[model samples]
Target: MLKHVQVRSSSSLLRPGGQKADTLSINSNMSFCSLHEPALSSRSSSYTSLNETQSSTGSASVPAAPPTTTVKVYTRCLRPDLEYKTMSVKYTTTCRDLVDQLLNKYRMKHRDPNLFFLTMEVATRSTGTAVRTILVLDDDSCPAQLQACYPRADSKFTVRMRHGGLVKVYDSVLMAESQYKSLLVSDRTSVDQLVQLLLTCYKSNESVHNYSLYEVCRTTSFERKLHADDRPLAIQQEWSSLAEYSFVLMKRPPGTPRSGRDFPLRRSFLQWSRNRELASWSGREISVIEERRSKSHRSPSLSLAPARKEGEKSFYI
Candidate 1:
Protein backbone atom coordinates (compact mmCIF):
# COMPACT_ATOMS: atom_id res chain seq x y z
CA MET A 1 0.00 0.00 0.00
CA LEU A 2 1.27 3.43 -1.00
CA LYS A 3 0.93 6.16 1.64
CA HIS A 4 -0.14 9.64 0.51
CA VAL A 5 0.91 12.68 2.55
CA GLN A 6 -1.40 15.75 3.00
CA VAL A 7 -0.15 19.29 3.48
CA ARG A 8 -1.64 22.63 4.48
CA SER A 9 -0.15 25.71 2.79
CA SER A 10 0.07 27.84 5.96
CA SER A 11 1.71 26.88 9.29
CA SER A 12 -0.83 28.87 11.34
CA LEU A 13 -3.57 26.18 11.36
CA LEU A 14 -5.53 25.85 14.63
CA ARG A 15 -4.16 22.34 15.39
CA PRO A 16 -1.08 22.00 17.56
CA GLY A 17 2.38 21.50 15.97
CA GLY A 18 3.19 17.76 16.27
CA GLN A 19 -0.41 16.56 16.72
CA LYS A 20 -1.49 17.55 13.17
CA ALA A 21 0.40 14.69 11.44
CA ASP A 22 -1.01 12.12 13.92
CA THR A 23 -4.64 12.87 12.99
CA LEU A 24 -4.16 12.48 9.21
CA SER A 25 -6.51 9.90 7.68
CA ILE A 26 -6.06 7.83 4.53
CA ASN A 27 -8.58 6.58 2.00
CA SER A 28 -7.51 4.12 -0.72
CA ASN A 29 -10.35 5.13 -3.10
CA MET A 30 -8.99 8.71 -3.43
CA SER A 31 -5.36 9.43 -4.37
CA PHE A 32 -5.50 13.22 -3.62
CA CYS A 33 -3.92 14.16 -0.30
CA SER A 34 -5.83 16.33 2.28
CA LEU A 35 -4.00 19.09 4.14
CA HIS A 36 -3.37 18.43 7.89
CA GLU A 37 0.18 19.75 8.04
CA PRO A 38 2.37 21.70 5.61
CA ALA A 39 5.68 21.78 7.51
CA LEU A 40 6.10 17.98 7.23
CA SER A 41 4.97 17.37 3.59
CA SER A 42 7.63 15.95 1.31
CA ARG A 43 7.25 15.54 -2.51
CA SER A 44 6.98 11.73 -2.45
CA SER A 45 4.73 10.66 -5.30
CA SER A 46 5.40 7.49 -7.20
CA TYR A 47 1.91 6.73 -8.41
CA THR A 48 -0.30 6.32 -11.46
CA SER A 49 -1.38 9.35 -13.58
CA LEU A 50 -2.15 12.20 -11.02
CA ASN A 51 -5.74 13.33 -10.74
CA GLU A 52 -7.08 16.65 -9.33
CA THR A 53 -10.83 17.11 -8.90
CA GLN A 54 -13.34 19.39 -7.16
CA SER A 55 -16.84 18.15 -6.23
CA SER A 56 -18.35 20.75 -8.59
CA THR A 57 -16.08 19.75 -11.45
CA GLY A 58 -13.18 17.31 -11.98
CA SER A 59 -11.24 20.24 -13.46
CA ALA A 60 -7.46 20.42 -13.81
CA SER A 61 -7.41 23.83 -12.07
CA VAL A 62 -9.23 25.38 -9.12
CA PRO A 63 -9.02 28.98 -7.83
CA ALA A 64 -8.66 30.07 -4.22
CA ALA A 65 -11.46 31.80 -2.34
CA PRO A 66 -11.62 35.56 -2.39
CA PRO A 67 -10.93 37.62 0.76
CA THR A 68 -13.72 39.17 2.77
CA THR A 69 -14.32 42.90 3.11
CA THR A 70 -13.59 44.85 6.32
CA VAL A 71 -15.49 48.10 6.40
CA LYS A 72 -15.85 49.80 9.85
CA VAL A 73 -19.49 50.26 10.91
CA TYR A 74 -19.72 53.82 12.12
CA THR A 75 -21.48 54.63 15.39
CA ARG A 76 -21.71 57.31 18.11
CA CYS A 77 -19.09 58.56 20.61
CA LEU A 78 -18.45 55.16 22.08
CA ARG A 79 -15.13 53.81 20.88
CA PRO A 80 -15.16 50.03 20.59
CA ASP A 81 -11.75 49.97 22.23
CA LEU A 82 -12.71 51.71 25.48
CA GLU A 83 -15.80 52.54 27.63
CA TYR A 84 -17.53 55.82 28.50
CA LYS A 85 -20.97 57.09 29.41
CA THR A 86 -23.03 59.66 27.45
CA MET A 87 -21.80 62.27 24.99
CA SER A 88 -23.55 65.62 24.47
CA VAL A 89 -24.99 66.24 21.00
CA LYS A 90 -23.02 68.55 18.72
CA TYR A 91 -24.21 71.02 16.05
CA THR A 92 -22.05 72.67 13.41
CA THR A 93 -21.69 76.38 13.73
CA THR A 94 -22.34 78.34 10.57
CA CYS A 95 -19.56 78.34 8.00
CA ARG A 96 -19.22 81.88 9.46
CA ASP A 97 -16.77 83.35 11.99
CA LEU A 98 -19.21 83.03 14.89
CA VAL A 99 -18.99 79.31 14.27
CA ASP A 100 -15.37 79.57 15.39
CA GLN A 101 -16.57 80.69 18.82
CA LEU A 102 -18.68 77.52 19.07
CA LEU A 103 -16.03 75.31 17.48
CA ASN A 104 -13.44 76.55 20.00
CA LYS A 105 -15.91 76.36 22.89
CA TYR A 106 -16.45 72.68 22.12
CA ARG A 107 -13.66 70.82 20.38
CA MET A 108 -15.35 69.40 17.28
CA LYS A 109 -14.84 68.72 13.62
CA HIS A 110 -16.74 70.54 10.90
CA ARG A 111 -17.30 67.31 8.95
CA ASP A 112 -18.06 64.99 11.84
CA PRO A 113 -21.79 64.13 11.89
CA ASN A 114 -21.61 62.44 15.30
CA LEU A 115 -19.82 65.42 16.80
CA PHE A 116 -22.22 67.74 15.01
CA PHE A 117 -25.25 65.95 16.45
CA LEU A 118 -23.60 66.23 19.86
CA THR A 119 -23.35 70.02 19.54
CA MET A 120 -27.06 70.39 18.67
CA GLU A 121 -28.17 68.57 21.82
CA VAL A 122 -25.97 70.41 24.30
CA ALA A 123 -27.14 72.27 27.52
CA THR A 124 -30.80 71.28 26.98
CA ARG A 125 -31.14 69.70 30.40
CA SER A 126 -34.02 72.06 31.40
CA THR A 127 -37.06 73.98 30.02
CA GLY A 128 -39.78 73.72 27.31
CA THR A 129 -38.72 72.49 23.87
CA ALA A 130 -41.17 74.58 21.87
CA VAL A 131 -39.83 78.05 22.53
CA ARG A 132 -42.43 80.21 20.82
CA THR A 133 -40.74 83.22 22.37
CA ILE A 134 -38.91 85.59 20.01
CA LEU A 135 -36.05 88.12 20.39
CA VAL A 136 -35.83 91.49 18.72
CA LEU A 137 -32.35 92.67 17.63
CA ASP A 138 -32.11 96.32 16.63
CA ASP A 139 -28.95 97.55 14.88
CA ASP A 140 -27.32 98.73 18.12
CA SER A 141 -28.72 95.85 20.16
CA CYS A 142 -27.38 93.23 17.71
CA PRO A 143 -23.89 94.80 17.63
CA ALA A 144 -23.58 94.43 21.39
CA GLN A 145 -24.93 90.84 21.39
CA LEU A 146 -22.62 89.89 18.55
CA GLN A 147 -19.67 91.30 20.48
CA ALA A 148 -20.70 89.44 23.60
CA CYS A 149 -21.29 86.13 21.81
CA TYR A 150 -18.41 86.33 19.35
CA PRO A 151 -15.83 88.84 20.55
CA ARG A 152 -13.39 87.78 17.81
CA ALA A 153 -15.30 89.60 15.09
CA ASP A 154 -16.64 92.27 17.42
CA SER A 155 -16.62 94.98 14.74
CA LYS A 156 -18.36 93.04 11.97
CA PHE A 157 -22.16 92.66 11.73
CA THR A 158 -24.02 92.13 8.48
CA VAL A 159 -27.34 90.51 7.51
CA ARG A 160 -28.17 88.08 4.73
CA MET A 161 -31.27 86.04 3.80
CA ARG A 162 -29.47 82.67 3.76
CA HIS A 163 -30.65 81.06 7.03
CA GLY A 164 -33.84 81.07 9.12
CA GLY A 165 -37.48 80.12 8.53
CA LEU A 166 -39.36 81.39 5.49
CA VAL A 167 -40.03 84.59 7.42
CA LYS A 168 -36.36 84.93 8.29
CA VAL A 169 -35.15 84.34 4.73
CA TYR A 170 -37.66 86.76 3.23
CA ASP A 171 -37.23 89.25 6.08
CA SER A 172 -34.80 90.96 3.72
CA VAL A 173 -35.02 94.73 3.57
CA LEU A 174 -36.46 94.19 0.07
CA MET A 175 -39.22 91.94 1.39
CA ALA A 176 -39.93 93.95 4.54
CA GLU A 177 -43.70 94.39 5.07
CA SER A 178 -42.92 98.07 5.47
CA GLN A 179 -41.47 97.82 1.99
CA TYR A 180 -44.06 95.33 0.65
CA LYS A 181 -47.05 93.47 2.03
CA SER A 182 -45.89 90.05 0.78
CA LEU A 183 -43.20 88.80 -1.57
CA LEU A 184 -42.95 85.47 -3.35
CA VAL A 185 -39.73 83.44 -3.29
CA SER A 186 -39.42 80.33 -5.47
CA ASP A 187 -36.03 79.35 -4.05
CA ARG A 188 -35.71 76.00 -2.24
CA THR A 189 -35.99 76.10 1.57
CA SER A 190 -33.64 74.54 4.17
CA VAL A 191 -33.12 74.53 8.00
CA ASP A 192 -29.60 75.87 7.59
CA GLN A 193 -31.31 79.07 6.53
CA LEU A 194 -33.44 78.98 9.69
CA VAL A 195 -30.41 78.84 12.05
CA GLN A 196 -28.71 81.57 10.04
CA LEU A 197 -31.67 83.88 10.64
CA LEU A 198 -31.42 83.36 14.41
CA LEU A 199 -27.82 84.57 14.26
CA THR A 200 -28.99 87.77 12.56
CA CYS A 201 -31.33 88.53 15.45
CA TYR A 202 -28.27 88.18 17.69
CA LYS A 203 -26.56 91.19 16.02
CA SER A 204 -27.79 94.24 14.06
CA ASN A 205 -28.23 98.04 13.62
CA GLU A 206 -32.01 97.72 14.00
CA SER A 207 -33.42 95.01 16.30
CA VAL A 208 -32.42 91.56 14.99
CA HIS A 209 -34.21 88.25 15.56
CA ASN A 210 -32.60 85.30 17.43
CA TYR A 211 -32.91 82.00 19.38
CA SER A 212 -31.21 78.65 20.28
CA LEU A 213 -30.15 76.09 17.67
CA TYR A 214 -31.25 73.33 20.06
CA GLU A 215 -34.90 74.39 19.73
CA VAL A 216 -34.72 73.92 15.99
CA CYS A 217 -32.92 70.61 16.47
CA ARG A 218 -35.54 69.55 19.00
CA THR A 219 -38.33 70.51 16.63
CA THR A 220 -36.60 68.36 14.06
CA SER A 221 -35.94 65.54 16.56
CA PHE A 222 -39.61 65.68 17.62
CA GLU A 223 -40.75 65.11 14.06
CA ARG A 224 -38.40 62.14 13.96
CA LYS A 225 -39.94 60.80 17.19
CA LEU A 226 -43.53 61.43 16.03
CA HIS A 227 -45.39 61.27 12.76
CA ALA A 228 -46.74 64.27 10.83
CA ASP A 229 -50.50 64.96 10.45
CA ASP A 230 -52.78 63.49 7.82
CA ARG A 231 -53.81 66.88 6.42
CA PRO A 232 -52.92 67.71 2.84
CA LEU A 233 -49.40 69.16 2.91
CA ALA A 234 -48.79 72.53 1.26
CA ILE A 235 -46.28 75.37 1.73
CA GLN A 236 -48.23 78.51 2.47
CA GLN A 237 -46.29 81.78 2.71
CA GLU A 238 -48.73 83.78 4.86
CA TRP A 239 -48.99 81.38 7.84
CA SER A 240 -47.15 81.50 11.21
CA SER A 241 -43.33 81.50 11.18
CA LEU A 242 -43.19 77.70 11.63
CA ALA A 243 -45.61 77.00 8.78
CA GLU A 244 -43.88 79.42 6.42
CA TYR A 245 -40.88 77.18 5.73
CA SER A 246 -41.40 73.68 4.31
CA PHE A 247 -38.55 72.28 6.40
CA VAL A 248 -39.76 70.05 9.30
CA LEU A 249 -37.55 71.62 12.01
CA MET A 250 -37.98 75.46 12.05
CA LYS A 251 -39.24 76.90 15.38
CA ARG A 252 -42.83 78.18 15.50
CA PRO A 253 -43.09 81.82 16.56
CA PRO A 254 -44.33 82.27 20.12
CA GLY A 255 -47.78 83.74 20.92
CA THR A 256 -48.70 83.46 17.24
CA PRO A 257 -52.13 81.89 16.80
CA ARG A 258 -52.04 78.60 14.95
CA SER A 259 -53.77 77.93 11.63
CA GLY A 260 -54.20 74.76 9.58
CA ARG A 261 -51.35 74.39 7.06
CA ASP A 262 -49.27 71.37 6.10
CA PHE A 263 -48.63 67.85 7.34
CA PRO A 264 -45.59 67.99 9.70
CA LEU A 265 -45.89 71.41 11.36
CA ARG A 266 -49.60 71.11 12.04
CA ARG A 267 -49.01 67.62 13.34
CA SER A 268 -45.97 68.72 15.41
CA PHE A 269 -47.82 71.66 16.92
CA LEU A 270 -50.57 69.29 18.03
CA GLN A 271 -47.99 66.98 19.60
CA TRP A 272 -46.34 69.92 21.37
CA SER A 273 -49.58 71.12 22.99
CA ARG A 274 -50.37 67.63 24.27
CA ASN A 275 -46.82 67.46 25.74
CA ARG A 276 -46.38 64.22 23.85
CA GLU A 277 -43.29 65.66 22.17
CA LEU A 278 -39.84 65.33 23.75
CA ALA A 279 -38.79 68.49 25.61
CA SER A 280 -35.06 67.67 25.55
CA TRP A 281 -34.29 70.83 23.59
CA SER A 282 -35.94 73.41 25.85
CA GLY A 283 -32.63 74.71 27.17
CA ARG A 284 -31.52 75.41 23.59
CA GLU A 285 -34.28 78.00 23.25
CA ILE A 286 -32.85 81.50 23.75
CA SER A 287 -34.90 84.74 23.68
CA VAL A 288 -35.16 86.87 20.57
CA ILE A 289 -38.55 88.35 21.53
CA GLU A 290 -36.87 91.51 22.71
CA GLU A 291 -35.20 91.53 19.28
CA ARG A 292 -38.54 91.17 17.50
CA ARG A 293 -39.45 94.85 17.78
CA SER A 294 -39.30 97.52 15.03
CA LYS A 295 -39.28 96.19 11.47
CA SER A 296 -38.05 92.80 12.74
CA HIS A 297 -41.58 91.57 13.52
CA ARG A 298 -42.10 91.40 9.78
CA SER A 299 -41.15 87.79 9.03
CA PRO A 300 -39.61 85.94 6.06
CA SER A 301 -36.31 87.51 7.01
CA LEU A 302 -32.54 86.80 6.91
CA SER A 303 -29.53 86.82 9.28
CA LEU A 304 -28.10 90.08 10.66
CA ALA A 305 -24.82 88.40 11.69
CA PRO A 306 -21.60 89.51 10.03
CA ALA A 307 -20.25 87.82 6.92
CA ARG A 308 -17.19 85.58 7.30
CA LYS A 309 -13.63 86.62 6.54
CA GLU A 310 -13.00 85.52 2.93
CA GLY A 311 -10.68 82.64 3.81
CA GLU A 312 -12.46 81.78 7.09
CA LYS A 313 -15.88 81.60 5.41
CA SER A 314 -14.82 78.50 3.52
CA PHE A 315 -12.82 77.06 6.44
CA TYR A 316 -15.66 76.10 8.81
CA ILE A 317 -17.58 74.46 6.00
Candidate 2:
Protein backbone atom coordinates (compact mmCIF):
# COMPACT_ATOMS: atom_id res chain seq x y z
CA MET A 1 0.00 0.00 0.00
CA LEU A 2 1.15 3.55 -0.68
CA LYS A 3 2.02 5.26 2.60
CA HIS A 4 1.93 9.04 3.14
CA VAL A 5 4.03 11.44 5.23
CA GLN A 6 3.31 15.17 5.23
CA VAL A 7 5.57 18.11 6.06
CA ARG A 8 3.80 21.26 7.24
CA SER A 9 4.71 23.89 9.85
CA SER A 10 1.48 24.40 11.82
CA SER A 11 0.18 20.81 11.84
CA SER A 12 3.09 18.85 13.34
CA LEU A 13 6.17 19.24 15.51
CA LEU A 14 8.66 20.58 12.98
CA ARG A 15 12.13 19.34 12.14
CA PRO A 16 13.84 20.55 15.33
CA GLY A 17 13.68 24.24 14.31
CA GLY A 18 10.97 24.69 11.68
CA GLN A 19 8.24 25.82 14.09
CA LYS A 20 6.18 28.77 12.80
CA ALA A 21 5.39 31.83 14.86
CA ASP A 22 1.71 32.53 15.59
CA THR A 23 2.13 36.28 15.47
CA LEU A 24 4.52 39.01 14.38
CA SER A 25 5.19 42.36 16.11
CA ILE A 26 7.02 45.37 14.71
CA ASN A 27 9.14 47.35 17.17
CA SER A 28 7.01 50.40 18.14
CA ASN A 29 9.82 51.70 20.31
CA MET A 30 11.74 52.52 17.10
CA SER A 31 9.30 55.42 16.51
CA PHE A 32 10.03 57.11 19.87
CA CYS A 33 13.70 56.18 20.47
CA SER A 34 15.04 59.25 18.67
CA LEU A 35 17.84 57.05 17.14
CA HIS A 36 17.03 58.78 13.86
CA GLU A 37 15.29 62.12 14.04
CA PRO A 38 11.84 62.22 12.41
CA ALA A 39 11.62 64.50 9.40
CA LEU A 40 10.40 67.98 10.43
CA SER A 41 7.24 69.14 8.61
CA SER A 42 6.13 72.00 10.82
CA ARG A 43 6.16 70.53 14.36
CA SER A 44 8.79 67.57 14.48
CA SER A 45 12.07 69.46 13.84
CA SER A 46 12.47 69.80 17.65
CA TYR A 47 13.10 66.02 17.99
CA THR A 48 16.35 66.10 15.96
CA SER A 49 17.92 68.31 18.56
CA LEU A 50 16.88 65.95 21.46
CA ASN A 51 18.58 62.83 20.04
CA GLU A 52 22.10 64.39 20.19
CA THR A 53 21.63 64.43 24.01
CA GLN A 54 20.18 60.87 24.34
CA SER A 55 22.82 58.43 25.79
CA SER A 56 21.44 54.94 24.87
CA THR A 57 20.68 52.97 21.64
CA GLY A 58 18.22 50.14 20.78
CA SER A 59 18.57 47.51 17.93
CA ALA A 60 15.94 45.45 16.04
CA SER A 61 16.11 41.62 16.36
CA VAL A 62 16.00 39.46 13.19
CA PRO A 63 13.21 36.85 13.04
CA ALA A 64 14.14 33.10 13.48
CA ALA A 65 13.84 30.55 10.64
CA PRO A 66 10.55 28.58 10.54
CA PRO A 67 10.50 24.99 11.78
CA THR A 68 9.85 22.21 9.20
CA THR A 69 8.03 18.94 9.99
CA THR A 70 8.93 15.69 8.17
CA VAL A 71 7.16 12.34 8.39
CA LYS A 72 8.40 8.85 7.30
CA VAL A 73 6.29 6.48 5.15
CA TYR A 74 6.84 2.74 4.48
CA THR A 75 4.95 -0.53 3.73
CA ARG A 76 5.09 -4.06 5.16
CA CYS A 77 2.79 -7.12 4.98
CA LEU A 78 2.37 -8.36 8.51
CA ARG A 79 2.99 -12.13 8.76
CA PRO A 80 2.24 -12.60 12.44
CA ASP A 81 3.44 -16.22 12.50
CA LEU A 82 7.05 -15.36 11.68
CA GLU A 83 9.49 -15.20 14.57
CA TYR A 84 12.15 -12.49 14.76
CA LYS A 85 13.64 -12.31 11.27
CA THR A 86 16.77 -10.60 9.95
CA MET A 87 14.94 -9.34 6.93
CA SER A 88 15.68 -6.31 4.74
CA VAL A 89 13.46 -3.22 4.74
CA LYS A 90 13.95 0.16 3.05
CA TYR A 91 12.86 3.75 3.77
CA THR A 92 12.31 6.65 1.44
CA THR A 93 12.98 10.26 2.45
CA THR A 94 9.28 10.35 3.28
CA CYS A 95 9.67 7.19 5.35
CA ARG A 96 12.79 8.45 7.14
CA ASP A 97 11.11 11.69 8.21
CA LEU A 98 8.06 9.70 9.26
CA VAL A 99 10.28 7.49 11.42
CA ASP A 100 12.10 10.50 12.85
CA GLN A 101 8.81 12.12 13.83
CA LEU A 102 7.58 8.81 15.18
CA LEU A 103 10.71 8.43 17.28
CA ASN A 104 10.27 11.85 18.83
CA LYS A 105 6.54 11.46 19.33
CA TYR A 106 6.82 8.15 21.21
CA ARG A 107 9.74 8.92 23.48
CA MET A 108 9.32 8.54 27.26
CA LYS A 109 6.26 9.86 29.08
CA HIS A 110 6.85 7.54 32.03
CA ARG A 111 9.09 7.65 35.09
CA ASP A 112 12.05 6.65 32.89
CA PRO A 113 12.75 7.67 29.29
CA ASN A 114 12.70 4.90 26.67
CA LEU A 115 16.07 3.70 25.43
CA PHE A 116 16.70 2.13 21.99
CA PHE A 117 19.47 1.59 19.45
CA LEU A 118 19.00 3.14 16.05
CA THR A 119 20.53 1.24 13.12
CA MET A 120 19.90 1.58 9.36
CA GLU A 121 20.25 -0.56 6.24
CA VAL A 122 20.05 0.40 2.56
CA ALA A 123 18.47 -1.04 -0.58
CA THR A 124 20.73 -2.96 -2.95
CA ARG A 125 19.28 -2.34 -6.37
CA SER A 126 20.66 -1.42 -9.79
CA THR A 127 19.36 2.05 -8.97
CA GLY A 128 22.72 2.22 -7.12
CA THR A 129 23.57 1.39 -3.54
CA ALA A 130 22.06 4.00 -1.23
CA VAL A 131 22.92 4.41 2.47
CA ARG A 132 20.12 4.37 5.07
CA THR A 133 20.16 6.03 8.46
CA ILE A 134 18.60 4.01 11.27
CA LEU A 135 16.52 5.83 13.87
CA VAL A 136 15.58 3.33 16.57
CA LEU A 137 12.29 3.85 18.38
CA ASP A 138 10.53 2.67 21.53
CA ASP A 139 8.14 -0.32 21.27
CA ASP A 140 4.53 0.34 20.18
CA SER A 141 5.54 3.93 19.29
CA CYS A 142 3.14 5.85 17.09
CA PRO A 143 4.65 5.37 13.60
CA ALA A 144 1.40 6.61 12.06
CA GLN A 145 1.99 10.07 13.51
CA LEU A 146 5.60 10.03 12.38
CA GLN A 147 4.47 9.34 8.82
CA ALA A 148 1.93 12.09 9.23
CA CYS A 149 4.69 14.69 9.62
CA TYR A 150 7.20 13.91 6.82
CA PRO A 151 4.80 13.07 4.01
CA ARG A 152 7.14 14.31 1.28
CA ALA A 153 10.23 12.37 2.40
CA ASP A 154 12.22 10.36 -0.19
CA SER A 155 11.46 6.64 -0.81
CA LYS A 156 15.19 5.91 -1.24
CA PHE A 157 15.74 6.16 2.54
CA THR A 158 13.95 2.87 3.24
CA VAL A 159 14.58 -0.65 1.79
CA ARG A 160 12.22 -3.31 0.35
CA MET A 161 12.40 -6.78 -1.20
CA ARG A 162 12.11 -5.37 -4.69
CA HIS A 163 15.02 -3.07 -3.83
CA GLY A 164 17.32 -5.68 -2.35
CA GLY A 165 17.17 -9.23 -3.87
CA LEU A 166 16.58 -12.87 -2.93
CA VAL A 167 18.72 -14.47 -0.21
CA LYS A 168 19.81 -18.19 -0.24
CA VAL A 169 20.78 -20.82 2.36
CA TYR A 170 22.09 -24.44 2.44
CA ASP A 171 21.35 -27.08 5.13
CA SER A 172 20.00 -30.60 5.77
CA VAL A 173 17.18 -32.06 7.91
CA LEU A 174 15.61 -35.44 8.79
CA MET A 175 12.03 -35.86 7.66
CA ALA A 176 10.98 -37.60 10.90
CA GLU A 177 14.12 -36.51 12.69
CA SER A 178 11.27 -34.55 14.03
CA GLN A 179 9.92 -37.98 15.11
CA TYR A 180 12.72 -40.65 14.78
CA LYS A 181 16.47 -41.22 14.24
CA SER A 182 18.44 -42.64 11.30
CA LEU A 183 21.66 -42.47 9.20
CA LEU A 184 23.42 -39.25 8.10
CA VAL A 185 23.67 -39.21 4.34
CA SER A 186 24.93 -35.97 2.89
CA ASP A 187 22.54 -33.30 4.24
CA ARG A 188 22.27 -30.07 2.32
CA THR A 189 19.41 -28.18 0.70
CA SER A 190 17.84 -24.71 0.52
CA VAL A 191 14.42 -23.60 1.60
CA ASP A 192 12.58 -20.61 0.21
CA GLN A 193 12.99 -19.78 3.89
CA LEU A 194 14.41 -16.81 5.72
CA VAL A 195 17.27 -16.98 8.24
CA GLN A 196 14.88 -19.34 9.98
CA LEU A 197 16.43 -22.66 8.86
CA LEU A 198 19.49 -21.63 10.82
CA LEU A 199 17.42 -20.98 13.91
CA THR A 200 15.57 -24.29 13.54
CA CYS A 201 18.87 -26.16 13.41
CA TYR A 202 20.23 -24.18 16.31
CA LYS A 203 17.17 -24.96 18.44
CA SER A 204 17.36 -28.69 17.59
CA ASN A 205 20.28 -31.17 17.66
CA GLU A 206 20.63 -30.99 13.88
CA SER A 207 24.11 -29.51 13.33
CA VAL A 208 25.64 -27.39 10.53
CA HIS A 209 29.18 -28.76 10.93
CA ASN A 210 28.14 -31.54 8.52
CA TYR A 211 26.79 -29.13 5.92
CA SER A 212 28.78 -27.96 2.91
CA LEU A 213 28.07 -25.88 -0.17
CA TYR A 214 29.07 -27.85 -3.27
CA GLU A 215 29.70 -27.70 -7.04
CA VAL A 216 25.96 -27.54 -7.52
CA CYS A 217 24.03 -24.97 -5.52
CA ARG A 218 23.32 -27.24 -2.51
CA THR A 219 23.00 -30.92 -1.51
CA THR A 220 20.76 -32.44 1.18
CA SER A 221 19.77 -35.92 2.40
CA PHE A 222 17.51 -37.09 5.21
CA GLU A 223 17.86 -40.32 7.23
CA ARG A 224 16.39 -43.66 6.03
CA LYS A 225 14.07 -44.29 9.00
CA LEU A 226 12.88 -40.78 8.29
CA HIS A 227 13.21 -41.61 4.63
CA ALA A 228 10.73 -39.27 3.04
CA ASP A 229 11.58 -41.06 -0.23
CA ASP A 230 13.84 -43.97 -1.36
CA ARG A 231 15.71 -42.34 -4.23
CA PRO A 232 19.32 -43.36 -4.81
CA LEU A 233 21.94 -41.39 -2.91
CA ALA A 234 22.84 -38.07 -4.52
CA ILE A 235 25.74 -38.00 -7.03
CA GLN A 236 28.42 -38.21 -4.34
CA GLN A 237 31.87 -37.52 -5.79
CA GLU A 238 35.16 -39.00 -4.52
CA TRP A 239 35.99 -35.63 -3.00
CA SER A 240 32.66 -35.72 -1.11
CA SER A 241 33.90 -38.59 0.98
CA LEU A 242 37.53 -37.37 1.18
CA ALA A 243 36.97 -33.72 2.09
CA GLU A 244 39.28 -32.51 4.86
CA TYR A 245 36.31 -32.45 7.23
CA SER A 246 35.04 -35.88 6.20
CA PHE A 247 32.10 -37.14 8.25
CA VAL A 248 32.17 -40.80 9.35
CA LEU A 249 28.68 -41.32 7.95
CA MET A 250 27.06 -44.77 7.90
CA LYS A 251 26.96 -46.51 4.51
CA ARG A 252 23.66 -46.56 2.66
CA PRO A 253 21.62 -49.81 2.56
CA PRO A 254 23.14 -52.26 0.06
CA GLY A 255 19.66 -52.63 -1.45
CA THR A 256 19.66 -48.87 -2.05
CA PRO A 257 23.26 -48.36 -3.17
CA ARG A 258 23.50 -44.74 -4.31
CA SER A 259 23.95 -44.29 -8.02
CA GLY A 260 25.00 -41.53 -10.47
CA ARG A 261 28.21 -39.49 -10.59
CA ASP A 262 31.73 -40.95 -10.76
CA PHE A 263 32.30 -42.93 -7.49
CA PRO A 264 34.39 -45.91 -6.49
CA LEU A 265 33.82 -48.92 -4.22
CA ARG A 266 36.68 -50.10 -1.92
CA ARG A 267 35.46 -52.52 0.80
CA SER A 268 32.76 -54.95 -0.24
CA PHE A 269 29.36 -54.35 1.34
CA LEU A 270 26.41 -56.76 1.68
CA GLN A 271 22.68 -56.06 1.90
CA TRP A 272 21.84 -56.74 5.52
CA SER A 273 18.99 -55.50 7.73
CA ARG A 274 18.93 -54.97 11.49
CA ASN A 275 15.61 -56.85 11.68
CA ARG A 276 16.18 -60.61 12.27
CA GLU A 277 13.09 -61.89 10.41
CA LEU A 278 13.95 -59.95 7.25
CA ALA A 279 17.72 -60.77 7.18
CA SER A 280 17.20 -64.58 6.99
CA TRP A 281 15.45 -64.73 3.59
CA SER A 282 17.33 -62.24 1.36
CA GLY A 283 19.41 -62.58 -1.83
CA ARG A 284 21.43 -59.85 -3.66
CA GLU A 285 18.99 -57.61 -5.58
CA ILE A 286 22.09 -56.53 -7.54
CA SER A 287 22.41 -56.09 -11.31
CA VAL A 288 25.38 -55.24 -13.56
CA ILE A 289 25.30 -51.96 -15.46
CA GLU A 290 28.40 -50.72 -17.24
CA GLU A 291 29.24 -47.11 -18.14
CA ARG A 292 31.66 -46.56 -21.06
CA ARG A 293 33.84 -43.49 -21.33
CA SER A 294 36.74 -42.30 -23.62
CA LYS A 295 39.98 -44.22 -23.17
CA SER A 296 42.72 -42.43 -21.24
CA HIS A 297 45.57 -40.55 -23.14
CA ARG A 298 42.86 -39.44 -25.62
CA SER A 299 42.56 -35.69 -26.23
CA PRO A 300 39.63 -33.90 -24.58
CA SER A 301 38.05 -33.07 -27.97
CA LEU A 302 37.74 -36.82 -28.79
CA SER A 303 36.71 -37.76 -25.22
CA LEU A 304 34.10 -35.00 -25.02
CA ALA A 305 31.64 -36.93 -27.30
CA PRO A 306 31.16 -40.60 -26.54
CA ALA A 307 32.32 -43.09 -29.20
CA ARG A 308 28.71 -44.37 -29.35
CA LYS A 309 25.50 -42.41 -29.50
CA GLU A 310 24.06 -44.32 -26.48
CA GLY A 311 23.99 -47.77 -24.83
CA GLU A 312 21.37 -50.54 -24.65
CA LYS A 313 18.84 -50.89 -21.83
CA SER A 314 20.18 -51.81 -18.33
CA PHE A 315 17.04 -52.74 -16.39
CA TYR A 316 13.50 -51.43 -16.02
CA ILE A 317 12.71 -50.23 -12.55
Best by lDDT: 1
Please report, as a residue range, the 10-residue window in candidate 2 with the lowest summed lDDT.
Answer: 265-274
Candidate 2 Cα outliers beyond 4 Å, as residue runs: 1-73, 77-156, 162-202, 205-207, 213-304, 307-317
Per-residue lDDT tens digits of candidate 1, residues 1-317?
A: 23556643544445554543334344444334347534324433312123222434655347754332211111223233433222222222232333233334344322212112111111222465622222323322322223334323212222222221223232334223432112222233223333333333434333212211111122223222212222212223322455433322223356532233333352333333223222332432213322553447653222322333464321100
Give TM-scores for every candidate, taking all chains together and pairing residue i with residue i: 0.15, 0.18
Q: Which model scores highest in TM-score?
A: 2
Cα error of candidate 1 at position 137, Å: 32
Evaluate model 2: give its lDDT.
0.28
Worst 10 residues of 1 by lDDT: 113-122
Q: How many Å off is the CA of 214 in candidate 2?
A: 4.8
